[model samples]
Target: MAAPVCLEYRIEGNDFMVAGAASNNIKNTLKMLGISSSVCTRVAIIAYEAEINLVIHGGGGVLKAEITEDRVKLTAEDEGPGIADIEKAMTEGFSTATEYAREMGFGAGMGLPNIKKNSDEFNIESEVGKGTRLYSTVFFNKQ
Candidate 1:
């Protein structure tokens, strides 16, 4: 069995240029670790969507990836304005992205929904003035 692997990324506010950087890194790492390509693709999508949320909504945050023999776990912690309504935020096509973010072809309100769709486990917590933290896991064994 291989030792567990972990990776961290710092996401900047409104940084569209590097929004997908962390996700790309994780994808490459998974490839190097011999994770199945199908699993890698799912993780990539989950990581990218979460990273974008941190960039467009969270102001700034840290994204972490933990890889083990059984599963891959992802967490996003941000220091921006937290989500006001968890239920509302989860709804598709509901976004509070800035005009600039919209101009970047992001902020389509698909980030969180996509994240939830791809992860085997998903949880999110947010405080209006504090911050938001997201937890998601993708298992290597499908059945």
Candidate 2:
């Protein structure tokens, strides 16, 4: 095994069309590096969900991915209005998305839950006016 590989990407707010680009890139990179298909799929799914959340919920954000020999770490940081009730937000049907977002078929409130489900570990922190940050880790063995 070698030292972990680090990758970083910037996600733009309200840019729905480009939302999944980062995750796609990460998937491709991992594939090129000969990562297992299962691990790559997990990473792609969670990363895509996180990226879309940044576009729809976050004003804009940065995504950092650290690929270690045994696991992958994903962190998303944004400057948008933070979640008011994280517990409720974590629920399946709770959402603060706008009508536009809803019309676009997003903001179904499944982003967080899906992220949590796909990751081995998940953590989220937010301030009403400041911003939000989410962290998730997926173990290769588990994949």
Candidate 3:
């Protein structure tokens, strides 16, 4: 088995110009590592979605990716004004994105759902004034 690898990135709030940089970098790294295409695809989708969410809703946050021979784990943690209703936030087409966010071609409100859909396991925890943390994992074998 290969040794585990961890990659981290900071997502700056209100940054539309550079959003998805982390996810794209991770995807490229996974590809260079020769991870299976299916697994890479899943991870890319989830990572991109989560990264964009952080940019739009997270105030500011970190994106972490831990990769092992058998799994890839993704975690996104943000500070301030966390989700008031996670359930509602998870619903498709329900977005809190601003007018500028829409102009950026985002705010379709599919980020969380897509993240969940692409993850083999997923969990989310949040507090209104504290923060939100999303944990998700995809098993290599699941592909």
lDDT of each: 0.90, 0.89, 0.91
- How far out, in Å, is residue 125 in model 3? 0.4
Better of 2 and 3 by lDDT: 3
Residue pairs in steric clash, candidate 1? Answer: none
- State how far residue 110 of model 1 sits from its true place (Å): 1.1
Cα lDDT of model 2 by residue, 4-92, tens digit: 78999999999978879999999998888788998889889889988998899888899989988788899999989998889999999
Pairs with steric clashes in candidate 3 = none
lDDT of 3 by residue, 1-143 (tens): 45788999999988888998999999998888888999899999999999998888887799999998889999999995898999999999999899999998999988899999999999999999999999999998622
Q: Provide the TM-score for each candidate, comma-separated.
A: 0.95, 0.93, 0.95
Q: Residue-wise lDDT of candidate 1 within 96-116, one digit each (tens)?
A: 888888888987887888899
Displacement of residue 138 (Cα, Å) in model 2 is 0.4
Error of 1 at 11 (Å): 1.2
Candidate 1 yields a Cα-based lDDT of 0.90
